[model samples]
Target chain A: MDKALLSTRNLHRSFGGVHAVKDVSFHVPTGAIKAVIGPNGAGKTTLFNLIAGTLTPHQGQVIFRGQPITGHKPHAVAALGIARTFQTTKLFPHMTVLENVMMGRHTRTRSGFLAGMFNAPWTWREQRQTEAKARAILEELGLTAHTNETACNLPFGRQRLVEFARALATEPSLLLLDEPAAGLNIYETQQLSQLILKIRDTGITCLVVEHDMSLVMNISDEVVVLDQGHKIAEGPPAAIQRNPEVIRVYLGDEHA
Target chain B: MRLRIYYPVLATAVLIVLLHLALAYADATYYMTQITMSAYYALVVIGLCLLMGYAGQASLGHAGFFAIGGYTAAVLTTYNLRPYADAPFVSLCRALGLTMQWKDLYGTDILSFTPWAAFGSALLLTGLIALVIGASVIRLKGHYLAMATLGFGLIVYRIALGTPVLGRADGISNVPPFHLLGSLQVNGRAPFRIQNYYLAWVVVLIAMVLALNLVHSRVGRALRSIHENEEAAHSLGVNTYRYKLAVFVLSAIFAAMGGALLTHYSGSIGPAEATVMKSVRYVAIVAVGGMANLWGAMVMGILLNFLSLRGVFGSFDDTVFGAILIMMMIFAPQGLLRVPRLRALGSLVSRRSHA
Candidate 1:
């Protein structure tokens, strides 16, 4: 492997007695697009949460860029070059798309309450720089037309794009996207796959938890198949499609 | 960019001047007393607005902070330290110029802390208390948060009413005036009323300008992000807990500053200012002014408080505020200025041109 940018070792998380993620282990190479796919209740989302620091693993470690980051808070994880989007579109509804992107620049900026309240000269300069960077991100995502519109006013697919733009504004080395295609139409899904490819080409690693099989198969450089909180298979997208175990898990026992 | 920030500030200055000129022309300068008092109350509203509006934290304990500030200043400035004049702490305070010698109503010489010392102590105590309270409670959300803060307010109220040193029901009186500079002072005497009115308004304007700057900056954006969705903000590297706690302490300081200055201006600090009703009143004014609108809160803070101070609502003052709260919650939860109908009205007129 080309030096894994992120690795989960023997991760385990449970809600009550039911194991949501059970002794799962995985790794993603630097600057690659990787996908974790499974049926409902297969522990994919739970696994993502554990890596993103939303939930602490009962056992095991998550190493990012050679450093163990297990049990860190979400914000702390984000500050260390990991950014994520929620399964649901969690855009700031009342804020404009431009402002939403600007919020992602939070950790990158240094102006605090006192500097802000006093309207310090540096804060003004920082604000302008943040605005310019945000505008550039919006343009890259082709969301410039909707820059001034409130985030919630956008259609579901467009809102997803705005969120993607926001996550990009954070300038994270690794982006964790949760169900980016959930509410998107087929056309929008295709657009999202293209965006994901563009993101990967930029040398940023992507770890995506997805449902749409075709979207995953098309864009993912490698695929990890999860079943009942266990890693059933992991390989290139082509091999995963041909794997007998993945087929059985997808089509039931008789079909296998 | 600078123009966007300066115009509103300039306009507010003009408005303040116009209001004073109009009051003087109408021979209603007597109303300035209530106006001046309202200005102080408005300070509390400004702080609460940031908490309840931008930060999306409902604090029903702001009056507790105000009382903490007022009582700290009142107790320090009025408590006789002459008996302990030889004590090291008292002598240290004297050497530091923190203590002053003045005559009481009976012409007795009394040694106490100066207004400056009292004011500094009030803010320091309020900030520390706010940090402790906020650390424990800022993690809570919605009704849980509201109830927790209400409980804090009640505790402060009880302490103010039951603590003998705070004068129980009679409260603390004989608070000395705060000397701001060479001639300017926060005093309630008739000769100082006009100057005091100007002083109070100037303080309010400075606060407003600072608040404006805050809300228009990056910190404001982060606060609004937290308000919209805390988890998402956290995912984006905004430390939601730290922001909430910081804003809580800042708002508490603002409330305490208001309380301390008002106590000095009135020459008294009372338990009534610490009551649950007072906190609710602050909440009501913020709601009526539009929760997130600083200017709206400041205006309604002064207007509603002035009316109540002038006995406009008669003996039903508390009842009137309670009713206003209920009405605003039901009829215009978005606040008077942000009512959907108002926006619809504007759009309706614009649509008429198309028709």
Candidate 2:
């Protein structure tokens, strides 16, 4: 209600005759950590894609920061303060970890081609600043020692952290993380939860599409329950835990 | 801070300058002239390196831009205007402000303009054509992009061959020789190969410096990112399409400049100079030298050209070049310059205990 940072009005998407997403509507309140959870085929990822401009809906619209962003390209949407991490880590594999993070700062850097080519004073200053900021982020994520290592050479858990650092480099007001906890072990998941809370403390809104219920329930301020592409329930984590429909669909009848 | 980088660059510069002076004094006109042409080819290879090595774009139509530049210089220098009845295309160009003067209509064989003016005009014309081509075809990627550029090159070659005023398949000859500004009267004489050699070297130096600056810039980094993963770069808010177009256009301009300088030095223009095979030769130069290393391209260009001139390589230049490219791709795809020995050399010296 506090001026939702992102809102969707009956977003719909279809792949030929199969309806992938059906009239799904949701609003992500600004600065809140929210999660969308459902079965694998219940359209959680599709919904995230539609909101992030990766897929255009067959009907309805997505509004970000009070402006229509329904049909903007992914890069254009990202430029307008929406950044996402892929479900599978999409690190620039050949680049050094620092360089991979530095790419996220691409849109923020103010130097032009001529200035960069000439190594102008302003461009050099900006380059150093960006690198320093990238290093700081890596340090925070415990990846400072791997700054010069190529992304592909890092262990899987650490690669995910690098991906998060790269996403943070974009300085996004709204972060759309796709399964940030997938493939992460128990220790990594705990660290990821702490990281998410730290991110939330920075006053940035997060919409996480995750299947790790324990992680989601522990960190999310609010949870939106989806069953077959329609919202079945939405509330604080405690209330959602007792909701019968959520129990029948997700928590199992035995738990109920 | 990096003595390895500084010392080598300094030594290379000193050697080049001493060699140039020796050639000037010893009157080794032919070898100096060959070095001049090699220098121009090196410039073209530098642009090709940016396109193929860093951006991961392939082009087989660079010869088209090269030929266009050659003809542009030839037309401006020797045949600015032709008999009206014989050359309707020249007449049209004259009317369109493409050609600078209408000397034939004035019943004068000589039109007044400095050699430098003609050179500048040719370079400008080459850049304009490359801009148009780049805008039209840069949207394409992969083999389709290569085929589109190759088509453009063939079309330009055909135009140069068919247009009678443009030398009608034979190309124009007896170009006015280049002169050092204010120092000598070498125009319209036996080719001033020595002056042209120095001129070509100057152009090559400028191209090398420009390329070195570009590879270290943000645009260069953006291009390398796009090459690695386009979707990831876009998701990070990089304008991938615009950067691709910018590199394509810049590479074409460099190729055009190289062609213009080569034509001026040779004192002739030919359709064969801008053939599809010639374009592939440029690609091979960059491929063998290492795609990401600009200095490697320079070394390979000089080596390839030197081999060809020595008659040791003979007409088997393409076969030998192709073999080297294949070997590089298989054994050291990153290029000879990127071998681990070179990377370890600096660290070895610094770690004195190990050394």
Candidate 3:
């Protein structure tokens, strides 16, 4: 059996009087696409932040590759090979699409202040490689034509694609995408689903928090359902669709 | 470095030469003194540009760094060690060639740290202070950062005003000339005016090359990313705090470098150099230069400092700087050169060249 690549052990968090996430435990096996689905205010985004280190879990732990990584800062988590995208695209607006992706290569590149100021030969070589890598990522995402345009000027769908290219540029083993299909059109949503599956096939595990059931059910190998900060169901995508508790949470009691 | 960045640096060198010729033709070589001083002031502005425009950090108390540099050099090079010559530390410094004996105007013998020794210590002290301040200060954003730095500047100014060893209101005077190598030296004397002018410009041009290279490379991209969206940059594994602190220290060193050089050139260091108004003037110059444009900052730094030094603003220097800050913030926040009309003109020129 494949060991879990990332696991949460009874993760718990609260804000003021409200419990954002309580006793949430799940595992993403290596090279699998796992989706966390829930209704509004169900703690999906909070859970995502906990894993990405934007928020600390008041209880329990986040384990990656069999090592505890709870409470690590966002940048430290990123350096440890966990990359994420925001629910609302947060690309550097003034930067070009290529530059935005190049930024993702920050951890991978080692040239810093002294080297940059002195124009060291190795920095020049590293920069050339960084640009080539960014361009390759853009080309793979079919964003080559838009690479030079400012990120804010791109169409919303293309902007989302750029974010994907940026996350991919980080070359993460575990990628966390928060609502990657949120504002996308139906066609864009379909393309995103295919892209997620393609990413999984490329040996990068994916843990996605998304509202679009079709996209999740289409690409996810397994699904975990949350309702009001508690796990309601966990199973294969087809099993999740038929889970009565998930149905009740998605629809009201009358529909159930 | 890219070949393109070399062009501007070369052009700046050529312009420096032409300006000297023009001044000689007009028999206005006296103006070279002010221009040389402005070049030193430009060093502080470019460093501030890196902090404010690129790294997205605001330092309202940069004059504090300048004053720290000036005061360090002033206090070290001006204090007479003749009385303590028998003391172990004084003798050690003297044995290390760090002390110089010279005659004051009254012809009395005085022993103090050499200008080179004083300059080195000034840079080291300024860098250490910036590091401590930045460790906590760079965590602040926007107005809070500005206010904190301003407070720091005020404290330095107060110390300069109240301290006895620093000369208090009288400041430090009769600082000896900085002797670089045989005959080549930094002093306000008439004979060395032309040489000092070239010396100052060469320093500015070298700083410009280093700054331009920094802004175009990987570190530059990281800084711009931080400026645009710090959260996003952090999530990409950029250590934003470390980068901010590093730039802060580097910029402080730049200001101190200018301070040390200027103090030597003018043969005096004063509490006025640490004034809040002086700090405000630097911010105004950076704003006018277009926050992110290094070349623009250098140009505006020289132009504004020269005008102010030549008494072009008469007695309204502080008022004029404050007004410029307010006006730029309200109207052309992108800076004078980066205003839409000029930006469009710039694009037009680029397009024509391409055609």
Candidate ranking under lDDT, highest first, comes to 3, 1, 2
DockQ (C-alpha based) per candidate is 0.63, 0.53, 0.65
Docking class of 3: medium
Give lDDT: candidate 1, residue A159: 89
Q: After superposition, how far is residue B199 of candidate 3 from its true place, in Å?
A: 0.6
Order by DockQ, highest first: 3, 1, 2
lDDT winner between candidates 1 and 2: 1
Per-residue lDDT tens digits of candidate 2, residues B247-345?
Answer: 877787787777776776676888987777778788888877767777778877877876776666787877777777678778776665456676475
Please give me the DockQ of candidate 1 compared with the native complex. 0.63
TM-score of each: 0.97, 0.87, 0.97
Misplaced by over 4 Å in model 3 are: B336-338, B348-355
The C-alpha lDDT values of all candidates are: 0.90, 0.77, 0.91
| DockQ of candidate 2 compared with the true complex | 0.53
Query: On a 0 to 100 scale, what is the lDDT of residue A47 in model 3?
Result: 98
Clash pairs (backbone) in predicted model 2: none
| Candidate 2: segments with Cα more than 4 A from true spot | A226-232, A243-256, B1-9, B21-29, B82-108, B112-132, B178-180, B184-191, B330-355
Name every residue pair that clashes in candidate 3: none
